[model samples]
Target: MKRPAPRTATTRHVTQINRTAILDVLREHGPLSRRDIQQRTGLGSATIERLCSALMEEGAVEAAGQVRQSVGRPSTLLRFASSARAIMAVDVTEYTARGRLVDLGGSTLYEESHTFALEGQDAGAARIDGLLGLVDRLASPETGVTAPIVAVGITVPGIVHEGVVTKAVELDWQEVPLADIVSARSGLPILVENDANATAYGEWHSGALANAHSAVALVLGARLGAGIINEARLHRGHRSAAGEIGFLLTSSASFSRYFTEQGDVDSTLAAQVLPFAAREGLHGKRIGPAFRAMMARCRAGDSEAEQARDEFFDSIALALVATSVVLSPQVIVLAGAFAQYSEESAEQLTRRLVGRIPWVPRIAVSDLGFDAAITGVSALTIEHARSATYLA
Candidate 1:
């Protein structure tokens, strides 16, 4: 095949960037008059008008009535066409694969989950098929959704470089051309990203770290991952392995053991505490019940329960201190299952880290929960779709 002509510093490319900028502004703070857009974007009135006209014509933006003025004609207000298109997002975890259809505004239109074995010869194919099936279900006309899926974004727990999974220990994957396979099978443009980076972007885009120009998102669960955002951009290191903090070795074991071992409150309560508690005459196996029981015991000043919770917090705080020293981010958002900790536990963890580090970053917990990765991927996919020449 003949190679396509290399792109140059053309007027069209510049216009496209400007258009994307306008869209971004509207997406963030919309229902603005053209003058407001001009003021916020520092673009000429004529340029804003031209871009708005094109965007409006393409169904990417729409006039949302007009802004009333005191002494002049009302100015037309423009807003992003958030419902005009949608993107499919898939998040592959150690034990499950989750898929969701989301719009430009990060609203979930549909979501479903499938459990799969994390290791074995068929694990990889099973995950791929599960994701494809989820997309098919969302796209089916029977679902009554009319918005078209313009792109697909998949977040994997590993190093993803140019759509390939260079390594994903959790899934036993190596050098898997994930994006190519998904795009070929689903017939839609695909973007593959590291799960931690995706989660961080998700939190930055719509969750706790939205206001931070520099932030670190630590996902503490079966796997410990960190996503770094510097100057409001995801900082993927030289080899796209920037957030694999799980591999960091500690004095006793890998740093991941702090979170992956019986350190997670829910997992610990379910796997270890519950069984032991049952043997000791407190028979509750469910996480909810076990967690409540543990908290109750701690509140009553039970030494054993408090000690367990304290150790968990200490382990997490140590990891946070390490991350803070390295990144010096303005904010650190804790995500994944560990975020389900009670407010007291979270505060305790924060308190534990107060004197450990010289600089303290505002620590927050993820509100998006397990959906962070998929949401971030959806946002990324939408960005790619918006920037594509064909989409423009």
Candidate 2:
């Protein structure tokens, strides 16, 4: 047998891995003495000291004073310097661009929201300008945040591939090079992700799904979108469309129609009571007030409103059954305006879902609400900043 070749040196790679490990430990466990880091990382005391010294010199870690031991000299505690750098996160919605300046510990340093007209001439350019202005406002010296911005993470309502928006029906955008354009203007590393995916990642990182092994975050609004997490990792399938559930067809209509047309609870209620409203000479009332009146009638035992409510529950149950069968997530998180439903509606939907699906995942309403996507993107930016330090 031929003699095996000698192993190539991997000292640098091992050192990088250990450095990252040390930083992660510090971040998770808070400040730790050098001895504590050594025990947690299984690295020798000398190696830990050497790495910690380098990190401290690089402004990635800092000594937080000393702890007196029982029998030996006091040991100095070290912590990951969470405020050493900052991240810029931008969330692009239908008509507003929201930005937040965040630190490594996921703390918001500053935030601003800018709204733009979506139907005027050069609307796309106006939206881009709005986003850039938001970034400029947050990153300016006037904000009093001394940390340098290391990266930008943008969450958009579209199919993003390698920082490009393949399609965003809401924005009427197609094949838009969003990341390159933003990077050119901002001069920082840029990452663009689908809004739903970002929200799911945000939930996984720090929200309701943080401890879940798998989850699906569904954004229910005029359009339906989903972000899937498997084994604690965001599952962006081939073409990054793993959770595009809007196109999934049901018996009544596509899932998107449920929230967009007569299938949605509010819209269905409006349609059912429109005849009643017209008969009562309430034709001038808008859908909002009509929806409220319909709900009131349902509470007062109106047969038509009750029928509409039952049909809405049935449609939602069918949609949930389809989603659960395919993804089988440990939990399903509901975000967007639909989360404002009354407790009775939630209970009814839950009962319907439990009756339809064999294994009913826990249904959760998002606490982050409108900030979920921005928060998730901010977390991604901080993660990128942390990785860059290791390379440095």
Candidate 3:
């Protein structure tokens, strides 16, 4: 590989730092006068003006209005030009790929979801084609994007290491160079991340867990996983697989089988629990109905359903407590469909965790919903775009 130097690395780093400081301040605090920016960042007046001028030319900043002063001249207020560039993020799940095109401020400009069924012998290649098709659609003009698309961030359900998806049993993918492939197809920079980790990051960055010192996003969708945050930073673990909490042997459900590629959620939910619920006439279709049925029955004083509810929630709390005891986040956010019953689920887990640990973190429902990965990837791509602002 050859180095592509638009500027010396030292100069580029300092430039990015200065730009990030000004842009971040404007972004976080909204519109501000140059004096306010100077006070906020401690950068000199001349430096601020020069950078602001460059940013305005690059469409990254714009004049908001002028602040009328009691004395002397009026000060011009500048705002971060959130719509200057588009950031596209796609989150790949087991049966669907949900994506969005957002501005620098993380506001959705375009959004679409494609539900796909990948089967047969050539599933992996088909998956890639389908995914790339989605990428193309996201970048299409129907998204109403007039600005340059800086980069695309992808989040997938798997153990993502570097730019490769090491394992995604749901997608039946292993060791796929997803980032390079997407980048090649789109001719743009690509950032790939594990879905759970991305969800945790999204929650921490701008959703339910925002401002918390530490937090964990326990994803209880069709599968079980987690995104861990410690000291306001993601803990990607060895090989960036830090929050694979599904494999923990904390499930209280007695199942005849062991974990397969899908991990414990496979054995616990799809195989053992749902099957039992179906056979026992708890639900006609799936886990959501089944869980609701059980809860309703248990509330109606059905002994069997009550006991079943206790065991199911105990299993979940086991997974949560197992991760919490180690990471010790200040809060744990529940992500996925099961989170719709957040209060009920929180009650179940909270009551079950009694005496299990010294202190129980606050349990919160995910405000980002299913698009957490999209929000998270937006965060990642925003950082990448900022870093490469003038460096590239």
Candidate 4:
């Protein structure tokens, strides 16, 4: 049912491979002499020199400084140019829009945000305008990001499939052709991802799970969910609904008055534990404070809080165990709100999985914190920029 891929390895292809190799080396370990690059990449002296020259001409690599050798004249040390180009990454929530302009080497150069209300008949159109306006504001030359932005990557708080947002409850959006619209309006390539997936990829690629090629990231914010990376790839499943762990059942109560739906973890938590938290005199504008208080109480040795915490872990443990049995990930990463109590959360989840699974995966906490998604979107944009028709 599938067509075979065409095989065509021309001289150009080999040159491209060598070029990519040189760039990768420079990115991983830079400020090295030409001889050092030859030694590391196994490329001949002529090829390394040629590729480095081309890369420097294209603004991807530049001279860091001169290093004098004991036996020869001062050798020029080369490094990947972090500010050669820029990537515009934005995160869109229900009420807030935050964006950053990052360089090629994953450094934040500038960031900006503005709040807007999504109301009335033209809310969808207004949302689009608001997003574009923010992009224009950040892209202004006054922000001081001088490099040309090659691509843009944005995260939406909903299901994104095939360049379209199928649904976003908080934003009241459906079947929005987000990527096409944005790319057309901005005159650059666009990448669209959900917030949870973006967070998971950001953590795995450069944050908590950077060392682990395959890991599971649990997003335990006001709403609970999971992001999965398998063999260094984001596993979106067949319909792009792979990591929706909020629908997992912890107790018998999920069957009655609780159906498996999108982002149902918060509802499940409230049904099972909020009553106990309320009884303890914890309330706030949103569920975040009360939930945080409950987690704290449980760690202080409160019986009721511990019971509720265990129940909460029950739901999460089901997802982790299932993910472990299937993918055998190297680690389980705690992200979002739960990351604040990563040690305790990891301990509780480990206790639940000690005997159930043949072996337990190590648990880690995300280091990027609230910036994970933005970092991830920026990385994705860089990748797209490299593979784009234009030269890096």
Candidate 5:
């Protein structure tokens, strides 16, 4: 399908709309020329030029450089200022971690991560303090940043209700005021999201499904989670657990159980999957080395590891296939640990998925790898920061 060029208009109301549209273009694809903006947005050349002049005057954007085409005169390119402002992106998931300083245009400046053991109430408190420390250090005037963290985007496992995390099954958190604590400590407007939903939103806004109207993301890490986006709004149902697909409980009792039969979840599993978990300041279980070795062997092509991977992914496929039937999204991106396993499983799942749904969403492994959460979280921060422009 052909995308129409941004509509160009001479009216003041249309110019206001174009202001938001121009920003979206630069945000999604930066350092664009006046011509590039006109093409992507379908706006008239004159209107684009006018808006660019006004935005420059308002300090919302700046002229970056001139673009030399293959066989034409250089075109002046405009881009969001790198120093426009910055936001904090905090990803606190069950299997990985990150805290980054991101700019309004979604560029990450600095980030850090490490392992952790977070479970129950006391652990949550400890994790919160640790995350605060990272924020303080990053936001310190000594860091040489152009701006402090004006907004925050955080992702976590389990169900988040308003600011309270009602049920983080993996973290064993119930009715916890997570957002309040983080907001108080950081002194920034905070937007907390379920990890999967955040990832899906990030992928969509980042143009992963550039051609599609909507997409779904299935993140397989320490546990399975899914996120859905249609018409650009996150489908967080009334309870705000819209993407909590982990608790769906496969028929395979073992697959459904979070811990081993012995009731022990090895720290290695935590290390292998959640090595950076603590650094994000999220609270969750910590697996030992034994679990890490097992996961490593699985990724390294060990036969036993292969079998485990196959079994785990096969069950995961069933859930995914089922979801495809319901949502029928344009694509389903597999992220986290499972992305490694998807190359082998995509075919199997596709073959078995025939006749199940009228249309099956294209299944592909996430190309973003471990950085999906961070990228998504960063996107979230930028989205909130630009809300004023969009809403106006």
Candidate 6:
């Protein structure tokens, strides 16, 4: 505290920026030529060469191949030396707990999941145990990782404030030091993030919205969670819980009430609304399983089934209309188990936007499937690692 770091701040800032740019290049278009990297980064050729050499020495990158497009001399292609490093990601949701071992390139090397009751007392402990089990599995001699574990990323649903679980209503977690527990187990650095934010990061990093610089990802599942990426950086507002859009009061008073009311409805049944739209049917398919089954039955030309689907589309349109009025983001990405339902939901959202708003955010479904959370956590870990290295 004795002002011992006068020039350290500037040096650290520069280092962080350099490293961030390097990592960003590798993430965007990896397995690149040194010249290509230099061109993309706009760094001096000598500096790029030095950085690449240093990174290679650190086992963060490796020569993958040579690009021989030009006649003069082929350029050696560099790829993230994935085998040389490892990171662990823990994804905790209301219905399941999953952990993945990822390489430096964001590729998942191994994954394991478990269904555990996250209600009542030992929930937090159980989750920690599961995560430890995952680390052990990946660190064992048989795993054959060249660089071992460098960091760990833990993602959980609910309001997370600086490594502490503030209010995970679904999991009944409160003020749990999740990051500390995981760090104690791994004896390595740990990063904790809201699961929704993680999903947004994943989508922004590797899913359908990867190219968008400004986007909002609304994850609809056990609870609706929103994560916003502004100018390619995760924006965690003042309290680190900035993207809690589900709590935004909709027609049913609160999102909890809205989602709760739909608990009894089977999502699979709800999906049929898409096909029904094709036939322009909606009267009988008001909302329920029988309506869903009827929609399915209409493949043979049952008019009523088609009508129910139309009504279903109308409901989705209303939701998207509300979302558009609020965020007005460049793009809106949907990622969750429920998102896998028929294209009707996405299509309906688009169709409703036609005349509803002067401008509409492009909506798309996440393509990363199960890997989005893990991928986002890995990206966050990579950024955190760069920051820590600069400080060192």
Query: What shift in Å separates residue 152 of candidate 1 from its native position after superposition?
Result: 1.2
Query: Which sequence of candidate numbers ranks them by lDDT, best first?
Result: 3, 4, 2, 1, 6, 5
Q: Among these predicted structures, which one has the highest TM-score? A: 3
Comparing 2 and 5 by TM-score, which wins?
Answer: 2
Worst 10 residues of 1 by lDDT: 260-269
For all predicted structures, in order, the TM-scores are: 0.75, 0.83, 0.84, 0.81, 0.69, 0.70
* Cα lDDT tens digits for candidate 4, 222-273: 4566678887988777667677666665566656664523435556566556
Q: Which regions of candidate 4 deviate over 4 angstroms? A: 1-6, 10-15, 32-51, 67-75, 119-126, 249-267, 273-290, 293-307, 389-392
In model 6, which range of ten residues has the least summed lDDT?
260-269
Candidate with more favorable, higher TM-score: 2 or 4: 2
**Deviation from truth (RMSD, Å), model 1:** 6.2
Better of 2 and 6 by lDDT: 2
Residue range 1-392, candidate 1, lDDT tens digits: 99999878788778877887798889889989998999999999899998899889988898899877567898999999888888888888766788788886667788777777445548767766766777677667766668888888889877889999987756767888988887887788889999889999999998988989999988754456789999889999988878766545445533455553222433433453454356446553333344445556777888888776666566557667778888889988877755556356568767987878889888787878877888888889978876662236
Q: Per-residue lDDT for 375 in model 4?
A: 78
lDDT of 3 by residue, 295-391 (tens): 6666688787667777788777877777778888899998875665778888788888878898899898889887687788889887887666644
Stretches of candidate 2 off by over 4 Å are: 1-9, 70-73, 251-310, 342-345
TM-score of 4: 0.81
CA lDDT, candidate 1, residue 148: 82
Which prediction has the highest lDDT against the true structure?
A: 3
Residue-wise lDDT of candidate 5 within 1-392, one digit each (tens)? 99999976667767678888998889779899988899999999899988888888866788888888668899888987646778888787543357888877677777776444554446655566666676677777766677656788878766777878776655546787877877887777787778788778777766454455767887765556788887657788788867655545445554644752112222223333343344344445532222234456665677865565455445556677667776778888776655555565566567666676688777776767667777787887777777754434
Looking at model 4, the pairs that clash are none
Q: Which candidate would rank higher by lDDT, 3 or 4?
A: 3
What lDDT score belongs to each candidate, Candidate 1 first? 0.76, 0.77, 0.80, 0.78, 0.68, 0.69
